[model samples]
Target chain A: MNPPLLDVRGLTLRYETDAGLVTATSRVSFQVNRSDRYVLLGPSGCGKSTLLKAVGGYLAPAEGQILLKGAPIRKPGPDRMMVFQEFDQLLPWCTVTQNVTFALTASGRLKAAEAEERARHYIAKVGLARFADRFPHTLSGGMKQRVAIARGMAMEPDILLMDEPYAALDALTRRSMQDELLQLWEEIRFTVLFVTHSIPEAIKLGTRILLLTPHPGRVKAEHRSDGTDPAGPDGELLSERIHRELFSDAREEEAGHV
Target chain B: MSDSGTVRLPLPAARTGAAPAQRRRVWRNSPLLRKACILLVLACVWQIYAVQLDKPLLFPTLTDTLQALWSSLASGALFTRIGFTLRTLLMGYAAGILLAGVVTALAVGSRLGNDLLETFTAMFNPLPAIALLPLSLLWFGLGNGSLIFVLVHSVLWPTALSTHAGFRAVSPTLRMVGRNYGLTGLRLVLRILVPAAFPSILTGLKNGWAFAWRTLIAAELVFGVSSGAGGLGWFIYENKNQLEIPSVFAGLLTVILIGLFVENLIFRTIERRTVRRWGMQA
Candidate 1:
């Protein structure tokens, strides 16, 4: 196959807390090709979010490396925009349009007029054209997340790093947002490194899903789906197989220990 | 997570009406109206007491004080003194705020800067501005410069301390977002920290203004010694020497009125526009 757009090899990440030297992830290896809806799937405390952060260049790897477009990932840059799970991710002081345009102008990527126009386009795309002038606090939780998504998309970065972006939303909103995101991907085919603990979300969103073990996350298995309708028979089988692989490890470990 | 059933309960009567419907409403909805009523009652009490005492010097009647206030205002003497005081206060307040801005900026930017700000504010914040008047007079020598110096001292520390606290209070998520947007150093401060921390900064400005106002008046009491003209403080002092105590009361009244005007009008308008509009303040 052609070379991947993003590559990770034997990556380990650790952080120093009050408890000292906690290993979050260990020797996690993965590669994401262009236009791949790559999902990092795991249980809670799996360090999938930490892995995504490392890929976003926000965290340094204790060992190994992350390469984006054949580059050694270093510091946070405009090329990798992040969508945090918090509703307060958008600056409250800025209107919706300003929040998106801020990223463009602040990155020195686009001028004022161009950034505003582009932001408007994405705002409209997110069905938030009317709220373009409203503050983040004025918007509902779902609407705020949409604004954040629009802001991330307006930058048109090489990749979007979304860390459980819908995990905070209510059930109905989360379902609709998943569909909205898929539609956006269908249109633009932008590369995304999505971290989530939801199996259905992974099945529904990912072209290739990386299943990770519980703590100090290590890759358990990789599964690929055609990114078609998850309600279809093919998609259902793929999801079942993924569920089996994802859970079988724990069962095997218990059996071995017993 | 399920929405499976409908449940209803009678709402509390207290929640609906607060009290019996037959009871008349005594309190006005507007705080301003309520405060005005309070002011009128206090004035009446003052009038009655002053009349019984039948002495203007010891405690001037409200009307007597108002007459003195009216006369000075009509003669333009009070206005000029106000002008001088405001000019001096503005200069000192602006200079102090600008310096605090720099100090806060430095404090947030690096380790050493933070250490320096912490040390300096801790040492100087408790030192009253009046305590520095003698030093200011000795150094700047009997003019607006001396008054301005003490005013600056009064305004700087609290402003710096509050602003620094504000900066520290900016959420890590916001800071990370700023950094992700390729913002660093001064740009990070201006765009993210300042706006997010503005409520605290505005509080700081308010505190600093009160300090500067008090310091300016007290400094003028002594500053009038050589400058030959002081602000409202000089007016009060001059009136005391002449035993025109009602005029002294008028001067004190003018000071209070001006303070009320600024606190209610200028600062309140600013707070309403920026922090309140942004939902940073209740």
Candidate 2:
């Protein structure tokens, strides 16, 4: 079998603050194959976002390593494009088209005309052709996320790393965005490493969900979800099953302590 | 269950012809129009007061100052003085900006550079630029050298300080984005940091310009009699010595007009086109 597109093994991430050292994640291991919508599902402080940042090369692993195409990751590169949740991710100075094109040109991936053409094509795919010349501040949060996604997709990176790209959107917008993302995935079948706390979002978008526990996040379980099964064994909903799997450990620990 | 009954009221009457007046109000409130009105009022008061005082030696009338300004302008003497001053100002200002750029670049680059900049700015920023006049005069021995020295002093500290503050304030996300795209060092500073910090940098430049202008005028007024090739400040001093009070007022008027031109025409236009258009500022 061909090697997985991304292989993260025993990756431990730490960051420093005014107080002291913070161990965000410890000895986490995962593999994302080509075209896999791999979701890191966890509650806040689970260090899922930090894991994503480590993959993006923004944070160094305190232990273990992240391998892309069997090569160890060193620093952030165009090969792993990131979509941040903040609307300010788009350069306020650049218009929507320019924002997408900037990534292409800045990475030296494409020439001016070709980059602009590809940027516009991706922008049209994301339904922002009308706002091609509008600044980021002018666009709504959902539209800005679309622009960010288009920028990431336009790069045709080895894997797209999204850190709650739609978590800040309204419920209606988030739903439509999920649908649009699925549609895009259908068209391109690009590999994605998505991080989110929303269970339904995990089921809806991810083909493989990696559940993580909080307080120095460790992988709890990995579930294969086609998002087609509403019910698991014993007539329980899949979301409920996943929820039980997540919190049941905490409940057991509490019972053991009692 | 609520006790209050629902009562419906008739629709309000439609407005009659207030749109034109509101539109006119918008036009009337334009910055240029309002500023012009204030200027007209101030000039009227100036004329009235000067006429009532009836002492041309102490306080000249608005017409007298204008007449003096017109005669000087026509004779082209005022132009020469203005040109000399502006030329000197530009030289010092350009040098100051270049030095500030280097200092700020260093400050952002490393801890040592940051320490150096912080220490130097703290020591010199509060000391008035004019205070350096005597020391500069002692070292450079009069003429435009000392004058330029003082001008650079005025421009450097504030420019460096504000620019450093601006660079420090650039958002981490923006910096990360720049780095994510393979941009590093000078490219990152130019493409990301500079534009992000421009509003503050512009503020610094404005402060530097004001400081440099004031310092130059004061320095020239004191000892700018260098080989009789002095600037507007020298011109004002010479006119005062000769008891040409009207001409002194004219020189002062010329200074005010130039200040207004730089602030309104140059700086305002830049602010409008860049920061305001970018929505970084309102």
Candidate 1 CAPRI classification by DockQ: medium
Clashing pairs in 1: none
TM-score of each: 0.88, 0.93
Q: Write the per-residue lDDT of candidate 2 for residues A72-147, one digit (tens) a residue.
A: 9999999999999887788877889999998899889999999999999999999999999998878899999999
Give the lowest summed-lDDT range of ten residues in model 1 chain A: A227-236
Please, what are the lDDT tens digits per residue for candidate 1 over residues B1-282?
Answer: 334322222246445565654333545346767898899999999999999999877998989999999999999988989988898899999999999999988888789999999999989988998999898878988788888889889999999999999889888888889988988877887888889899999999999999999888888776564455569888899899998988999999999999989998999999988887777872
Best by DockQ: 1
| lDDT of model 2 at position A204 | 93
Clashing pairs in 2: none
Worst 10 residues of 2 chain B by lDDT: B5-14
True contacts kept of 2: 0.48
TM-score (2 decimals) of chain A in model 2: 0.97
* TM-scores of chain B, in order: 0.88, 0.89
